[model samples]
Target: MPHDIHIVTEAELRDIVTLDLALVDVIERAFAALSEGGVVMPPVLSMDLPQANGEVDVKTAFIPGVESFAIKVSPGFFDNPKIGLPSLNGLMILFSAKTGLVEAVFLDNGYLTDLRTAAAGAVAARQLAPAQVETAGVIGAGVQARLQIEAAHLVRPFSRVLVHARDAEKARACAADLGQRLGVEAEAVADPAALVAKSQLVVTTTPAREPVLMADWLHPGLHITAMGSDQEGKCEIEPAALSRADVYVCDRGSQCAERGELRAALAAGLWDRGTPPELGDVILGRATGRQSESDVTICDLTGTGVQDTAIAAHVRARFPGAGTVIRA
Candidate 1:
């Protein structure tokens, strides 16, 4: 008899997992596993649909000794917002590592991606940001922009937040919403450079093809987490900004060189391959983090398959028997 396959819904995931320190720890462990050579992850499969302003990415990973692995399909239709639909959507397929059997399907509609990405930001902040941060900054007003700041607060106490967006109204609304939710002072800034100047830690979460944050505005004792630009031709920070950082890190150097911020820097001849250590190396004590209080650090995060695997495992652990097991 075949096992009954379990199907988990987005609503259920929302109820079970949250964007907090616990999730951050899970993501951190995933990075440590990667650095320790305990995970098998392949290059992401990506397809671009220029006419529709959309892109699709497929990612997967297997962690040694873990019961299950996950393959996630993520799609982003930038024009969806014009029709009142979400710009991002996706699901994960979980399989038993031992017997190659389908165990569950998480129809999370990209919730896990958002959760893990935010958690990754927090992990970066925890490892590189100054110990005391009163003000944090974000470059976009989308769902990720809000979540990154929320996650950062879990690691550092931020009393205020500054947000910069191309649309002034959207930035103001995002600031207001964040202020209400986190009970902190949140304000909108007209200039991205100004936001970078005022913040001790900054997160860029936009989908822009061009640079939004620049190097000239970056100051010492500041840390940046660039979470956008997971696809080709998308960039949030200028290549020069990366050059200015005393310590430059990436979630994965190979992936970033192909699609993340490092791609642009490498193209510009500003960065060398594998010059910066992977975030996992820092987390695993294989590399140093934040050597001095005045050191500037930048973390370029290109969404990784290990993160999907880790978050999937965590969700399964938290909600056992939530899915219907199906026979293979």
Candidate 2:
């Protein structure tokens, strides 16, 4: 059997494993693969689409190690609720790392991307979070927030889970659903300040253009995973909050500086551009993650194309070209 070049559809990608396993595993593998070397996953290339309410943008990533990385082309047509459709739409292209071959196409439908990002939350929990956190706080009760609740439970096993969203009802619903799934107590917090003040660990998953997280609200021994601000002008966590942190880590400094949560900090003079280390640097033993029990650590994830390649590898390997092929 020659390498069966299979291309999976969006429906197929949705039928994969559960959120905890797929999302967390993809993220963990992405970082691990990067640390092991031979993967060229640069920060994504994106341009703003001002015609589409300024929210719409086109971004593509090329992973040199995978032979084929994902373009990850997506458009944020968030007004789709009235139109009865999804807000985000896109597909992931998995090309053969060898021979520069465009091997397979996986119709991610944004699910794989979400999972990989959630996996980064899990990794942050493992690496940046302290050993004694009993309460966890989540900002933005969306799909990614739900996944973080699941992943954090697997790592922290918090006694209480707190969530805050722009919509209180949605936050309540997410809290209930996450609590039901994780077998823990979950509550919809009044706001970011309330949530951060109560929990030892915090994960933000909003796409707010301004800061939702407050600097004065955080307590000591807090570990923050800023997941929402992966694009320029999209910031959830406040830059000043980072000043209170003892350590700061990022998925990629170059990528984050242009688009991640750190962009706000860099702009506000809240952080030293040369100080925060990349997660790979920490994983590869080139830098440190946590220093003290009293120290605060923040992991800012901007996401990378290598994650798509890593997850695509797992999916492709499992299927082994199990779809119809079109040679073009």
Task: Kindly report the root-mean-square deviation of model 2 from the true structure over all alpha carbons.
Answer: 2.7
Taking all chains together, each candidate's TM-score versus the true structure is 0.96, 0.89
For candidate 1, what is the TM-score? 0.96
**Predicted candidate 2 versus true structure: per-residue lDDT over 202-244, tens digit per residue:** 9989989988887877677899998888777898877887767
Question: What lDDT is obtained when candidate 1 is compared to the true structure?
Answer: 0.90
Worst 10 residues of 1 by lDDT: 319-328
TM-score: model 2 vs. ground truth? 0.89
Instruction: Estimate, for each residue in 1-328, the C-alpha lDDT of model 1 and write its tens digit.
Output: 5777889899988987898788899999999999899689999988888999998999999999778999999998999989999989999988889987888899999999999999999999999999989899999999999999999999988999999999999999999988998999999999888898889999999988889888888898999999998888889889988878988899998998888999999899887535679999999888888998889999999989999999998888778788555566
Model 2, residue 35: distance off in Å is 5.3
C-alpha lDDT (0 to 100) for residue 229 of candidate 1: 86
Please give the distance, in angstroms, between residue 243's alpha carbon in candidate 2 and its true position after superposition. 2.6
